[model samples]
Target: MVAVGYTLMCEQAGPKQLVDYAVRAEDAGFGLAVVSDHYYPWLESQGHSPYAWSLLGAVAQATSRIDLMTMVTCPTRRYHPAVVAQKAATMGLLSDGRFTLGLGSGENLNEHVVGAWPHVQERHEMLEEALQIIRPLLDGETLTYSGDHFEVPEAYLWDRPERPVPIALAASGPSSVDLAGEYADALINTEPDPHVIDLFDSAGGAGKPRYGQVAICYGPDEEQCRKIAHEQFRWFGLGWKVNADLPGPESFDSASSFVREEDVADSIPCGPDLEAHVAAFKRFVDAGFTHVAVVQVGDETQPRFLDWARDEFLPRLRQL
Candidate 1:
């Protein structure tokens, strides 16, 4: 059976509210939960970006059953890999082995705040090095390493779970997918494309859990849903290449100025159609994703969406 999960969008929700949402998601029957780690909201109108690690710590205490993970944290620049290993290790213990560390090469919007922006290839190289440093530390090993991209001098995680936290690497292309196959316990992708699954499996990710995220809006009014999705998430239409390069909200706003309601509607399922929501997720299942995270687009509609998910959506999805 495919594992259904809920997305706790930290960029769109406050810390306490996000913690509460995790509890609600567990009650709603979601087996896993993923949260975005962002320094700033994609669009200022969306209006929030709390510290993801701190919020996750609270979530670990608040929820008992649901699995938690970072949809993707960039351990390359804004924070060092050693720091990420430490934090993730603590989280694993706090959640009693329920935490997974999802990592990516990162984007300028979040990693640029520290005032250095490397080229795309350089970032990927940095990510590989970061993973090398993180993996051993999570296994409770002390390590010293000097790499072209990173340096560590006798670093070790003082507190760790009995087992190493699972690492899920985010991939949007073949190169990253291959990296994930070689290094990660799982693979995470935003799109529901079978080609991605094919590439991952061919590159040695066969039998590993493939994770995906689907964005949608749930409400009674279609027009309102379209408007909300367009306002809050149109930045997503820019594609990863552009999304990774853009430095801030202003750049995203300028880039998405031409985005219309139709564009948003086409990308994210909207309104009260139960089949639309199920179909949106089915795309991932069809693509061979073993785990999927559904992100409800608007903050105001979260409670209603969760209620509907528990009562309507999840039950039907499980049968699929």
Candidate 2:
């Protein structure tokens, strides 16, 4: 069976609401849950960005059965890898081995705020070095490294879990995929592309789990859902190259000024139609993704969407 997880969009909800929804998700039958780790929301209209680690601690305490993970966190900048390692270890212990650390080479919006904006290749190299620093530290070894991007002087996680927390690396292109294959316990991608799966498999990741995320908006009214999706998630269609380089919400606003509601309606499944939502998920399953994270856009429809998923969507999805 494909593992279906719910996305706790920190950008769109506050800490209490996120914990409430995660507890609801466990009660509603989602086997796993993932939260976005962002310092800022993609757009100002979406409006909230709580410290994800704190909220995750609350979710871990509130829910017992569901697995939890960050959809993606960048350890190269803003945070040193050693800090991430210590945090991930503590989260793993808090969640009783149910936590997975999802990582990626970050976007300019988050990483650039630290005052150093590296190019894509440099970012990838930084991520590789971060992984090297993280893996050994999580394994409870004292590590010292002087790499091109970062340096650690006799660093080790004192409060680490007995086992290393699994790492899932996000990949948007060939280089990232290659890195995932070489260093990660799993692979994550936003798109349903078989070529990516093939590339990962051929590059030493054949048996590793692949996770994919799909954005959708479900409401009683199709038009309203389309509007909400367009308003909040239209930045997703900008392509990774553009999405990774853009500095802030205003830059995204300027870039996506021409994006239409119909364009969002075309890409994301909107409305209460069960088949449309199922088809969106099936694309990822068909592309060989073992785990799928469904991001339901908009805060107002969250309760309804979770109810619908538990009662309608999940049963059909399991059958698929």
Whose lDDT is greatest here? 1
Each candidate's number of clashing pairs is 0, 0
Off by over 4 Å in 2: none
lDDT of 1 by residue, 1-320 (tens): 89999998977888888888899999999999998999989998888999999989988999899999999899998999999999999999999999999999988999899978899999989999999999999988999999998899889888999989999999979899989988899999999999989998988999999999999999999889999999899998899999999999999999999999898899899998999999999999998999999999988889999999999999999999
TM-score of each: 0.98, 0.98
CA lDDT of every candidate: 0.93, 0.92
Residue-level lDDT for 185 in candidate 2:
90
Poorest 10 consecutive residues of model 1 by lDDT? 10-19
